[model samples]
Target: MRMRKILPACVLSCCLTGLMAPAAFADGCPDQEIAVETLKMKRAEDSEKAGKLKEAFNAAKTVAWECLGNDAGKRREALIKRVGRTLGDQEEKQGRLKEAFDWYLAAGLEADADRVMLKRANAKPDDTNAVGNAIDHFKRRNNEARVREMRGIAARNVDKWLTAEDKAFAARKDSREELGKARDWVYYAEAGSGKVTERAEKRGDTLATDDARRSIENAIAYYQFADKPQKAKGVRDKARKLGDEHARKGENKLAVEFYSLAGDDAKAAALEKKSEAEKQKTESARQDKFKKDQQSLEKELGL
Candidate 1:
């Protein structure tokens, strides 16, 4: 009876050892490691397909870690990258660009990151400072080609935006919000991108100059109406420079308006008087010419 029990126990112990041997005594990379990684990858794929992005991101990370040891012929590595890039694409579609960029960076998707960087840069198309930040980032990365391209695009965008502001300023020049936004972009362009500055100042012949005067005058009026004398005075001080520019350019009518807004009533009145005189002189010349034509006609008709 003792022999029988000992023999059966020995056989049972040997069978258990045989069953556990592959995992216990195998090399660092056991055959089952590949199988385990594949199963994890499958879970990641399922999570992604189900739109469980957070879960998918976590699951894919596990698979990526597994790939470090068991990826054969780099197949698992390729799968990890593919899954990561797909997750980033999903995030991008949802307008989560920063999150998308993070995933792309993790997935080793440089091209995808580049594309998102451009879109993110232009997300606030009217905000030139926002665009400038992107340009600065690209410069740090030594992406000169992208920097040039972005500058051109940013210049055109702001130039278009300034056009809309110019039209609005003509009607709602007293709107501080509109004028402030215009100033923000104009200053950014002037500071960061000469391309934008040139387009802004040169496109409408005297677009920036004209708008500067008009904006200042409107701002002064707005502040004065709001009982903010100090603010109005400040605006008027700024208007004087614009008034001088117009006066030097022989735009007497505009100079009159700007000087008046600047609280230089004497200068404004003088310019207005000079303009009236010029208008009278022009009318006189027209009348003299008309009289000459009438006399010629009457003489020819013997009237």
Candidate 2:
């Protein structure tokens, strides 16, 4: 009985040792390039499954570059793509967006890379410094669509900052310095994204335009209430120009609002009158159309 137990134990130990031993490269490929690539690719997959991403990434880098050029049969291409995608996902989850983007690109996934970059820009939409950095990153990469989107985000963040600043200023009438700092952020938003304001206006987004106007009005109120008319001159000029531009476009109501903000009571009142007249004129035209339709129906029926 003892001899039988020892024989079984020795057999088990030999089997375990063989299984744990490093894999031989003899069965991989006859060519050196193929052999090296095959070995590294297998190692990469194993390391990744074992949660050793750093080792996986290093191994994958070698396989992704070297294997593609060596393997004419495209044997390792699928594994290389898989490794690149996996590394990108891991890096993105860790907030390493730049690395993730590069990995995705190397995987030949351009759309995935762009999406990751956009997410990076949107990650800190409410943070001025962070959003600014994201915008700069997109700009340097010549991503025009992403730059525009980032600018819109920056403008929105400025609005949020202005709202908080408004509450603080209201609570403390002596918070001129704080208000001035808030105005600087507003300026930064406009300066950082030259097209944001123009695009907002052209898009006819009522809420977006209102948000922008409110922020600018807050700045004007701050300077005017602080008895600094000279300092508010530039803002007043901008408001006046906006009003004139709206009036020329036949947006009399918006023009009136802007003129009022500029402290141009006369221009605002005149624009308001024009808007009322235009509304009445439009109503009258609708009524006339209704009457004409009724008369045509009566004539057709010989009523």
Residue-level lDDT of model 2, residues 193-276, one tens digit each, is: 233233222222222233356655755655554455664675676788889998999878778888887889999998888788
lDDT of each: 0.66, 0.66
Best by TM-score: 1
**Candidate 1, superposed: residue stretches over 4 Å from native:** 1-54, 62-76, 89-103, 119-137, 186-303
How does model 1 score by TM-score? 0.41
Candidate 2 whole-model C-alpha lDDT, 0 to 1: 0.66
The segments of candidate 2 whose C-alpha lies over 4 angstroms from its true place after superposition are 1-42, 45-53, 63-68, 72-80, 90-108, 173-303
Worst 10-residue stretch by lDDT in candidate 1? 200-209
TM-score of each: 0.41, 0.39
Total backbone clashes of model 1?
0
Against the true structure, candidate 2 reaches a TM-score of: 0.39
